[model samples]
Target: MKDASRRVRTEGITGAAVSAVMRDAGLTHGGFYKHFGSKEELLMESLSEAFQEIADRLAQVGEQSKPETAWKAIVKTYLSLEYCDHVEYGCPLPALAPEMARVDKAMKPRIFEELKKYRSRMLPFMPGRRTADKERAFFSIFSTMVGAIEIARMLPEPVMREKVLASARELLLRSF
Candidate 1:
């Protein structure tokens, strides 16, 4: 599942071929059936795993930092070049959301559930007092972070990408 999650994050759900996923997992293409019934099933499970990976990461950042600084820390981490360059290990939204938006009806509910779970995990570290305020902050912060990473990933030069990430990081930190 790790390989599948990573593959889908680096290559969109549509682009990550089953044979490549199988090969990366050290299994033959035929072996894929022993796991998932279909590619959509594979994507469903992998996307869940991907959300878990990022949720745990964000939770860890919140746990390890001072409460007042947790929001800033998360923004910084999410907007870092490391996160930008390491798409497979970073948040799933930037890479997956576009394709996810056009996923089949069967997959939409599953994806939405995973997103809600991910949001629940993220809300605690958001920079706001009221529950409503925190909820708003969560959406605003993450949407910007995801957009920043996507744009950074699209740039050709490392310097240009870093500039994008750094600018977003600075602007986001100031919001809190």
Candidate 2:
């Protein structure tokens, strides 16, 4: 199951190729069926694990004493080279958001709940905004972070990678 999560995050959940990879890892194809009622269940579990990691990182930052500091930390961490490069082991927003939009209805609620938790953590730090405004800002922030990381991942060269991270850092830090 651990390996399944790792593999799915890194390679995506799909066809015979993934099955072959699992077999090579010495996990029988049937082993997965025994544990999960369906592939969607397995994906949900994997997403939960991924969400836990993001939540833990966010908790480590806490609600900063100065709201600006919180924003700085959020932008820096979310748009960093490390985050961009670690798609499989990192936030699912970049790796899974589009796919999740088309996934099982049950999976949608879990993802929304996880995102809600993140928004809750962030709300205290965003000042003078209505709930709707804050929610919009949160979504905007989330989108920018994910887009920056996605762009970083798409770059073909080391210098381009640095360029993306640096540009994202500059733009995002300004939001703080």
Candidate 3:
């Protein structure tokens, strides 16, 4: 499952070959169906696992400091070059979102559920006196962070990429 998560995120769900993933996992390509009903099932499960990994990391950040401080740390770590480079093991939201949007109907609900869980994990750290306001803030910050990382990853130059990351991190931190 972990290998699948990494493969799908790094190579993309549609782009990754099932045979290659099976080989990486030390299994025969034919054995894939023994575990997953279909490619969509594998993708949905892999996405769920990736979301859990990210949620765990975010929870740790929230636990390590005050809400605002934790938010800063998360923003810094999330937008860093290391995170951007490590798409396989890092956050799947930025890595898989574009592809997921066009994925099968069966996969969309699973992705949506995982995203809701991810947002719920971050809600406590967001700034808002009301639940609705907090939800709004969380989405705003989360979208900006994800979008910034996605854009940063697209740039061909290292300096430009760093600028985008640093600027986004600065702007987000300042807003909170």
Model with the higher TM-score, candidate 2 or 3: 3
- Ordered from best to worst lDDT, the candidate numbers read 1, 3, 2
Candidate with best TM-score = 1
- Report how far off residue 39 is in candidate 3 (Å): 0.7
Candidate 3 lands at a TM-score of: 0.91
Residue range 17-40, candidate 2, lDDT tens digits: 546544534556787677667666
lDDT of 3 by residue, 1-176 (tens): 78878888899988888787667656676778787788777778788888888878877877787865776777777888878777897888899887989987777787888889988888887777788988997888888989988998999888888899899988988886
Ranking by TM-score: 1, 3, 2
Predict model 1's lDDT versus the native: 0.88
Question: Cα RMSD to native, each candidate?
Answer: 1.4, 3.4, 1.6
Give the lowest summed-lDDT range of ten residues in model 2: 15-24
Model 2 C-alpha RMSD vs. true structure (Å) is: 3.4
- lDDT, candidate 3, equals 0.82
Error of 3 at 2 (Å): 1.3
- The TM-score of candidate 1 is 0.93
Assess each prediction's global lDDT (C-alpha) against the native.
Answer: 0.88, 0.68, 0.82
Top-lDDT candidate index: 1
